[model samples]
Target: MSDRITIKFNAAQFLTSAPTLKHCPPDTGAEVAFAGRSNAGKSSAINTLTQQKKLARTSKTPGRTQLINFFTLGEEQTRLVDLPGYGFAKVPLEQKLEWQKHLAKYLEERKSLKGLVLVSDIRHPLQEFDRMMIQWAEDSQMPLHILLTKADKLKKGPAKNTMLDVKRALKDFQGEASVQTFSALKKEGLDQLKSRLTEWLTPDEADQAIEELIDQDSE
Candidate 1:
């Protein structure tokens, strides 16, 4: 296998926000999406990953991220998607359903989606909505990386155990799955998360060489 490319997450910039899959940018590039329940630190993780203080807005009120937001790396074809937060009880049932419908359509139909990052609070991991996401990824044969956010809130021992427990719980998923502890405040597990995203979004050396050759020929 060819060597993998390194991605500069810090350079990520807002691309666009789409209310539904139809509004999304043309589906022709590799993108990994982040999903989690409202106030579960999903936005924090995104900001931390990109080393940007405000790449994704962190709201005190839950369910504020009603749209699917997209961020592009140096290349438009490499992207990181911030999906709408789920399981916000304050939202009306109809609105919640609408968000879920759009989310499902994007996950099920987006050809450029390469993987998923499911963020959950380390203190309360694997809630109902999180399990639903895991099942969806398994059914779709999509690779998933679970981020146990807020690791700084717990003692080291408990945090480690939580990571292990989450891994054991997902042993039956049958698709590519991994778990790690993270703390946006502490900047913990940032490298691991970056590595996973890079693996998903970066094209290998062979593909890069071919693209370069094609560009040269076109010129």
Candidate 2:
């Protein structure tokens, strides 16, 4: 596979509001969205997965990414969505409500959204808000995957055990959802997360993927 299978995030268009999201092109390309609490290392994880510096900007400031960001994954024409982080610190209620409205509408209605990559803190697996979001994704039938960020902060045994605890908590949701320990700082789990993301690329873009499997089988 091409290293550019994930490309530079060439554009970060800031739509004024969620209602304007309808104006986006309705192309059939696969879309993998990333969402987590503000400052939960979403941008860093994206950068690590794509192996591109600054594809998504990391920030200590809560709620720096206040709009939906889009990027193409090179020649195969995959779409990656960087959603605005929810639950920012010290934000006004009205602004939070506005972001929530936009994000909820997009998740519930986007036809081309093939999957969602939900990032969360490894130490606290399922906060109530995260659980509610998982239920929503489950109801929407979207293929879901969890990126347990900050894995490097914990010891290996504790990290693996925490992952299992998370998986056990997800048994009810549908689709092939799985959890992977990740740390953009440590560069841990980047390759594994990228491999999981490969499953989200549009079926058409996955042709050589099938052929490669066949070649392996033939050998």
Clashes of each: 0, 0
* Pairs with steric clashes in candidate 1: none
For residues 1-219, could you state the per-residue lDDT of candidate 2 as single tens digits? Answer: 454354333333222222336755464556788888876678888887777777788877778778788776663346778888865657788888887777777888887787889889898777765776688688778888999999999999999999999999988777668889999888999778777777566354466687579789999
Single out the weakest 10-residue window by summed lDDT for candidate 1.
Answer: 1-10
TM-score of each: 0.92, 0.81
Task: Identify the leading candidate in terms of TM-score.
Answer: 1
Off by over 4 Å in 2: 1-20, 204-219
Q: What is the C-alpha lDDT of each candidate?
A: 0.91, 0.76
Candidate 2 local lDDT, residue 99: 72
List pairs with backbone clashes in candidate 2.
none
Report the error of model 2 at residue 132, Å. Answer: 2.5
